[model samples]
Target: MNVAVGCKVRFLNDVGGGEVIRIIDKRTALVKTFDGFEMPALLSELVVVEPAADELLQKKTVQEKETAEANRKKKPKSEVEYLTDDSPEVADSSGDELSLDIAFVPSNISNLQQSTFDMYLVNDSTYRVFYVLSNVIDDNHTPISSGILQPDTKVLVKRLTPEDVSKLIIMNLQAIYHKNIPYKPFQPEFYDIELDPIKLYKRGNFKRNDFFDIDAYIISIASTKREAFIRHLTDKAIVEAIKQKEKPAPVKEVKKPNIETEEVDLHIHELIDNWKDLSPGEILKIQLARFETALEGGIKSTTTKRMVFIHGVGNGKLKYEITKLLSSKYPKLRYQDASFKEYGFGATMVFLK
Candidate 1:
């Protein structure tokens, strides 16, 4: 009997059983009980429970439940043994091809414009395969479904709302397969599908497929005996890293560029493009603003020991104003006359604190 994940099954010898949560191998599977106990059991020892049987089991009374449990085989617990990968039964296959696809079947095919989707994974091959479907955004992988798919089986993985379908981004799938018996080695398959959210709304894009009855949008990651596409994961980033690794070593003593002096020309003409029509107050304001900016730079700079401010020896108003502001707002800074030979005593030098 072929089994897949999420199949409801019951223990043949035990009184009760649970749904199949994982397929361990061809002959072994992991079943989760109603009480949340997950135990390994052989596929042969567990029988699939139909939907009707589940309803009757739920409605059964305490006495009826006990009677049902008593009717099961009274075999000892020692008789149960889960098959391992090395077991003879784990060997089996679909000949050569192991294909799979991510399908999105519209809920209302007639009205595809406003319909939601029922997302599913279709394993077209005859080999039982394990798959993980996830969305990758901003380098983070979030799982949507992680389970085993029986050969030639399609499982409903998610019910996508219209909003979810609209914001669809890149998705990734990873899979590994096992057979009913030993078969030739097969490599793990991976895919990074860049989904076009707009395609889901286009009625003409949906085409008939073998796995689903409706015209569903399908993304085949693996086909025939090999992968349908290639993955160049972060190749650009890796190339950049290699380029940095191969860079030449720095010089033994790299010479620093000469930084002669830090100077500021607070002349109104240098500060603004069109200032001839401005008032004296506005003109002084612009000059003072330039002075404050230069002062801050001198104070914060590590290498600069001093800064020169060309206030010009016009009416000494600019010089007096600079001194007064420096004394009041910046007590740590000291000011003195700049070089009389170079600036004709027009510039003032401030000793950066």
Candidate 2:
């Protein structure tokens, strides 16, 4: 690339561009940037910006060259001026306004029953506040607005309706504050405060009145001044109360019904009430059903190896039916007359396989 003095060129390895001032050697040239710093750059390290914007840029480059030459001609050369991004130093200021805080208060102190609740963001401390109020929904922090809050004053950010009160979520606050003194201000202090949703919006949850004239939610952010100790336990208790729901009582276990004794009475009076009104045939059928049920139970039981039925020697008809059922349905069973000492010739004991 052919280069000459007063030509605009860009630094190949760095961000900015400047005008070439003087060629030091075959490989190097001195360049001056717009911010007024001159440095030696390699000819290969710069690329000439083709078709420079106008002749005015070339004129400015020539004027800079003249200024550089005039400064060098002085008896004692002036010190070279370098540009940077740092602010100038200043002395620290002394004041009692050395802290910052964020707070909230209701606008109408006299009438607390208003439908539309007007709330204020109060800058309770002396330092000016630059703050952002973010609605923390889910895991995201969405900033509503950001601005400066003057000390000891309040800014109304919301005139909330009753529905707005319920729609309230977490308020994620981040702020940096410093005393607004002319001298070098105090180092900016950072604050991150998460306002509880219930306490921040729900009016019925207010537990104390020490910080405000009326019952209100006051958030304290890094303030050295003391206010009421927040009743976080109260909020916790309210949450617990809301979460408490009645749980159904645990189900009771039921026991399986089984034959109560080795000897089952098939007599109608023993099995049911008011058997005198039943016909003779109905009584016999009931007695046979009980006998069949008891025999099935004995057959299925692991521990019940024998069952004795006291059919009371009823004309031998019940016995004939019982014997027929055992022979046909339960071929694995055997039967004989029960003990004469206990049943007196009326009971029969059936044995299960």
Candidate 3:
């Protein structure tokens, strides 16, 4: 049977089942096992468990909620995981069993202009959350407000700008917890979260909130926390990187004769020292090779705006060959007779564009 990503499937050879993460090809697929191991297996080696992933995802969410609620009564005070700002968003027991979900809801007024997106910090577990919201602006963290969020309650954290939506910045939440049967309160925890820019603008990202009676961006801080990694670079290096990105590449500069030489000489003797033993055909070949090389070099250069190739008035053969090559191969370059005051009718001046 043909399978697609996000479908639930069981391994034919193994006793375990998993969700299909990716369709590698016609014959292969990447499966994410229930035990969290992702492995590539042949399509024939898999059997469809659930064609729709939404059912599986809903079942998993309900199971987690039941588990979190059951742990609320029997959770130990000292038993806790070292929670950090940048970590996976797996809900854990902190003696009193607390779980927080940070969700962003966008304004969905049909004709609304410049939406002021709303952010909600929800307390899912049975404990009250004392929360503080801070905004990171211009490399500085500014405190917005602090309040106590009751159990199974949510509070508006802040309104976001479109500029803020596109950036990496998000509200930093620091909070302590409280419970009626708790031995001691849980320590303050840090969480960094931001709505995905691509998803934030999408109409599907927001759903009709029966509670709020409007549409909003709902970001779940349930399964994973955004990483708080920063890159360190010197000012000079940053400036150089910006310049490289914004600036177009410059043309290479070519070497040219000074005012004394006036033009490049393509004569056989000027091209090579040992030309006495060389045949006339070989001499002509060497002169043409040197002339082609000089012409290409001048064309690639920004400094050499105009250059003259002195091939001499020898039977007009060399001149005719150079003209034909320029017109056919190097059609972009315009060539004509050199200045009458300088080389007279012998040299050709090639204009480099």
TM-score of each: 0.42, 0.31, 0.32
lDDT of 3 by residue, 236-273 (tens): 44334333433454878877546322367877665555
Candidate closer to the true structure by lDDT (higher is better), 2 or 3: 3
- Stretches off by above 4 angstroms in model 3 are 1-97, 109-113, 166-168, 183-187, 207-211, 222-353
For residues 213-247, could you state the per-residue lDDT of candidate 2 as single tens digits?
56665544454432122222244443333234224
Off by over 4 Å in 1: 1-91, 225-353
Q: Ten-residue segment with the worst summed lDDT in candidate 1?
A: 226-235
Clashes of 3: 7
Clash pairs for candidate 3: 89-223, 89-224, 104-217, 105-216, 105-217, 106-216, 106-217
Give residue 246's error in model 3 in angstroms.
38
**Local error of candidate 1 at 103, Å?**
0.9
TM-score of 3: 0.32
Order of candidate numbers by lDDT, starting with the best:
1, 3, 2
Model 1 vs. true fold: TM: 0.42
